[model samples]
Target: NDKLKFTIRGSYINNLTSKNSRVNLNTGVTWFAGKGWTVNFLNTSSFHRVTNNTGSSSFTSSYFELGINKSFDIQQPRHKYYNYTAVFYKDLNGNRIHDANEPGVSDVLAEIIRANPEQDLKDKNYNGEFLSNELYSNDKGKIEYDNIVEGVYNIKYIPKDIQNAHYESEGTEKQFVAKKDTVMYIPFMERNKLFGKISLHRTQHSALGDIPLGNIKITVEGNDKTYSALTDKEGYFEMYIPVSDYYKVKINNIFREHFTLRQESYIIKFNGYKRFELSFDFDEKARKIHFDESDFLITDEEENGNVSFEDIKVIKQTNLRGIVKDANSLLPIHAIVSIFNNKTGELISETASSRRTGVYFTSFFAGDSYTIKVKAQGYWTYTEDLYLNQITTFDNVNRDILLRKTYIDEEIKTENLRFKSGNSELSALAKAELDNLVSTLFLNPDIIIEIGGHTDDMEALSVNAKQLSEMRAKAVADYMKQRGLSEKRMKIRALSNHDPKSRLDTPEGRAQNRRVSIIIAGF
Candidate 1:
């Protein structure tokens, strides 16, 4: 009887089976590789052993078979992303773009910066500092940048080794974005395209070309920038400015042909694509610009409106006359008279008087209010308000005004003199009046005056006269000396108890006796 036992062994096989006199074992292994590749190995083994080994001579039989198989999971290729590029060239001259064969060409530095679309782009130099990652242009005045993300970018260019060369191109900043793969071009041009002609015409149909207005500097300021140009031989000048906001133009010259003919400044709103013609008319004789009368129109007219000849009725044209005098003495006071419109408060005229007669005259329209203000040295200011509502024809309005003389002393019967009670010290108010007197003497240079002191009859004649008169007279002399007044221009005298202007029996009379007087000696 022949019986058999089967056993199978392998790294990947855990069990073996046999049927119909044949056995098969399954085994497999897997390995991983880079780039998404995989490898696998499998094997099958079978073995037969004599079960009735009683014979001990039974033979063992084994069968093995190797099979190979391959399977692959394919993968697709990935797409590559591309970036945008920007290139530019700067022309150092003002003649638009650079010529191919131009000589003495200098290098220009430029930088390309990526700007985040979600954020606003700002120049790093705003805080007066330079930032990193700024690119510079090549020696050929060329700049290029690439691998820029899909967003905005700014290109900045600066000229190298060029001094005093004018530029009219867009400044260092060029704003652009790379929505898709794109190539951007930025060209910088020079600013030397300024040229223009100017002609002047007079109302007399004469050309004033002979008037030499040498290189008048004309400045155009706009968009946080300023540009200057000079007037040419034909009184014409042209200036080139970067394309930006409107420009404010101003002209300046040495000679003012007319008070209004000085360079006029205006806004030039037009773009620089076309030529602009500006005509200037100057009247040298009248020193004024002959503008169309229609330009000066009165838009509003009311009873109390501003002074406009066409707005109100001139019921009468009168020369108003007035005299300013000391309110207490009715004596004329020399002063400066300033007249103004009461409604508009505009000073219409002013005049100064040489003599003590404070008289002034000016023309005014009827039914108008006028204010006259008088200002004099050492005198309180006097102001008068007048309403001319009655005069219907050309007439003279006599308005006399009396200004109160500012006195250091009122009871003392003396002109421009003051004193402390029972003492020779001059009061502050008295010193102020004396200061004016001293100024007058200095101005005249040849004027002289007598300083006199007086006393009342209450004291003994000889003793009171000597003491009181001497003290008072010495006080005046000392004041003059302190004020830089030459002693040669003054003389002192003490009248003592003599020449009393008031009665000795009354208190007012005694007060008047204690006084001092300034008598003008000569001019």
Candidate 2:
């Protein structure tokens, strides 16, 4: 009996219905909405058994689940109290109580923010948000919280499925001292909005060209709300505003003005020209913007479908610039510059060095010869003839001119001052002309001169012309010194008939050959 007991074994049942595999066909549709609200239209009733025992009876089961759950509040205090409710109304009075005249605002967002620690449960999820689809408020405007805990909370009214209304927070945030089974309530408010499209452009301030202006900031200041948007890549923008008062609009720091939204929707364009129109499109929405074409005006509309504004700039040509200076000092000086067109033999332009700065500037053309004459009142004239040899389009050509002091050479004159024949005495005319020369020296105290006398060939061969000329030059020098002039201001010299004023055999030649010469020595 002991050996039989140790060898004994049990027989197995092959297949039982409950012991076989079961199929769980989960088929649920979840509709996720904004602000963390979701609805699960699920059928938990679909199920079947895969395998069953041959001698056993099988069974099928199905059920429908209709439920609502809240977000697992990680900050929810331990639930030792009753559940609570929150109602959203169309309007609430200043006393924070629901009035009998106020109707319920269904589908309006209601949420409870808890101020407590959470119990970390692994399987049961709590997302920490609330929804009011319960039978207590007739399943209309109430969000009920189960397993209520003691904590501080705030109830907010959030608008959903918004249309053309201006929805703003109406100071409707209600703080909850949530006791046990209390129903909290708050008000939701809204206004109307003025919708419009804004188009911007950067047309060359001139008639030359234009381009799309993008990334420019546009701000709309209004009574109820202020909106800001940056222009897109296409230089287009739009704004949805609340009840339009006199709204002041600013476009990038360029300019600002105010406008009233009397119509439903309008279009604004910053354009370069009145006739040039930039194209855009508008859709047929409930409150759509319509642009009636018009030239850029602060307060006016055209019969056509357009809006325009003017923003222009002038075009300019290239120029040449530099300073005029004294050649010795290398410092700026006021000099007169005369430009001449050598090809046309005409004076093209005349510019002067600025007395204040001595800087000079002018424009010129290529493929032309220009004679630049730079002169000052006290300095020698500087004449420079140049050709704009290279033909190219560029800017800022530089040309600086320097002038020297003036000095005169008496030999450059055609006829020299004459004396009486065979006599070293000054002629009546000669002394008269000498009066002018002396007066010039008197007026210009800085001027000094050299005096020289020369004789003709026939007169020199007959008399001691060399000695006579020397005596004549000395005599003229003495006359000037006796006239109250400084002897240090003059130098006297003489020459024979070798240097003649003229080569012709005539009385005029002989008279010009024998003369006294004067030269500027210093100033």
Candidate 3:
């Protein structure tokens, strides 16, 4: 074996005045002496000249140096010739170093250590008695050492007045006790089994690919213990982890996106090994969508017996029935029916369809006013107020709902009316109806309706007809006027003692005779 020595040198110069010529020179030498003490020499020079004869000048400079070096012996003698190399840039003029300062800069720091500090011995000096080395950086922040042994070493740098350096070294070659066999014991009580599969498909055809992604890291976190595994080429991953009260798995893709799945925190009590599988699909355009435990088939014990099929069949058989139809045509019409509590406004049931024959049959409790709102996509929603007191007996209630198709051309009809007996005064219910009429009229100013009054056969023909008809007609006109209906479009007429639609023989028939009507005379 020989003691090897090497030297490097360099220089540069720039001429700022006239012609501005620059020159640089570098040279080095190496020597090997059989006795270990190797000596070497180096030199560098620079010269600059102004080509303009008006004020021409030239300057030159050179450096000379010598050094001696030797090797160290340690128990791990294989590292005797080991060395490290580093390059750094000085913040000269607030910028890093350049070629001009090479071979002359001195004292920059360089540190090398076994990445696994537990296995490598620690030391404070350059005795070479142990597993690491630290060398000062040069003025130009560059240093080199050669012949280091094969091992993973972390390199750190301490820049003058800058932050401390950090790095990571990887690979099994850095492990000491290479010939020692190590075993890890996983007790049955502490083991957990997790199974999952990932699928990658084409965005356009949804075609699956056989190409699998191996080395995908899956981490399970439980009881502060993190278990990691690499997926197989088929995108399947399974591993036994330490049983913890709570657990979650994190999947990280090669593209840097991550997905996490959480599990309930409870002891799994089973006769055999507990296993679960998670399946998911991946789209190139949409990335990955993780499927949770609910997406997989799993079983749990129920302390109480499960409900029987026969019981469920009986429950479904007793539901109420209903049919929805168009009011004007008596034809079935598809509609969305949402049953809500009239007082609370909470929904009790809902159904929808798009065909002409819309039928809904659902259950409900008695003694509540239920509001059924029916809406077809493009049609106005129709609401009906119904009191369920009629079905308190628990018998099946058959309801036939007639939904009027909302027409853009049709205005509200106001023919239904009831008046106080033998008086011109309007009833409270009539006043409310008249308010609605007023709103309709304001919405469509072109609409016109004739208000007509009639009476039943009573008193003398002339007096009974005149008083009954005039009072009824004037009562309706007064109500419309109070509700902001324009007098120009509303026409009041009293056919009092003249027209009689019913006889006065019975109270029901007589009540129907005292009424007012609104006819759509023109639009």
Clash total of candidate 1: 7
Q: Model 3: per-residue lDDT, tens digit, 68-106?
A: 666533435443344445555432221223345323324
For 1-523, candidate 2 gives per-residue lDDT tens digits of 3111111222223336356444444455555443445555555443344454465344556656654445543444533355777776654332335788766665666555653425423315444433323232323567777755555666655656546434333454577765666876655433333233343332322111222234445676655556776565466665543333245555552111111223322243222211212223222213223555642344534435343343322223235566898889888898777777768868765666666457765554443577777767666556677655543354446688777655655431313367666778876666666665675566456667778888887898799998978877877787777777799888887887877878978887887877888777776
| Model 1 alpha-carbon drift over 4 Å, by segment | 1-85, 90-106, 114-132, 161-163, 193-281, 285-344, 347-523
Q: TM-score for each prediction?
A: 0.27, 0.26, 0.25
Give the Cα error of residue 295 in candidate 2, in Å.
37
C-alpha positional error of residue 374 in candidate 3 after TM-score superposition, expressed in Å:
3.2
lDDT comparing candidate 2 with the true structure: 0.56
| lDDT-best of 1 and 3 | 1
The most accurate candidate by TM-score is 1
How much does each candidate deviate from the true structure in C-alpha RMSD? Answer: 28.3, 31.5, 27.0
Segments in model 3 whose C-alpha atoms lie over 4 Å from true places: 1-323, 327-330, 335-352, 359-370, 375-400, 404-422, 427-450, 456-470, 480-491, 503-513, 518-523
Give the higher-lDDT candidate: 2 or 3.
2
lDDT (tens digit, per residue) of candidate 1 on 1-523: 1122233354322222421133446555545443444455555665433233253122334444433334442222222223444344444333434456433223556565655523533633233221325555454444444434444567666666445545424656777755555655455544434345444444452222234443557777876778887776567787666544366777663334322453466676555443444544444444234656755664566335665567434345555666777788787777787778878888876755424345555554454677777777655566677666664465667777776544433222335464433556677777777787776556445556777887777653435566777788878878888999988877888887677768757776676777777766654
Measured with C-alpha atoms, the lDDT of residue 492 in candidate 1 is 82
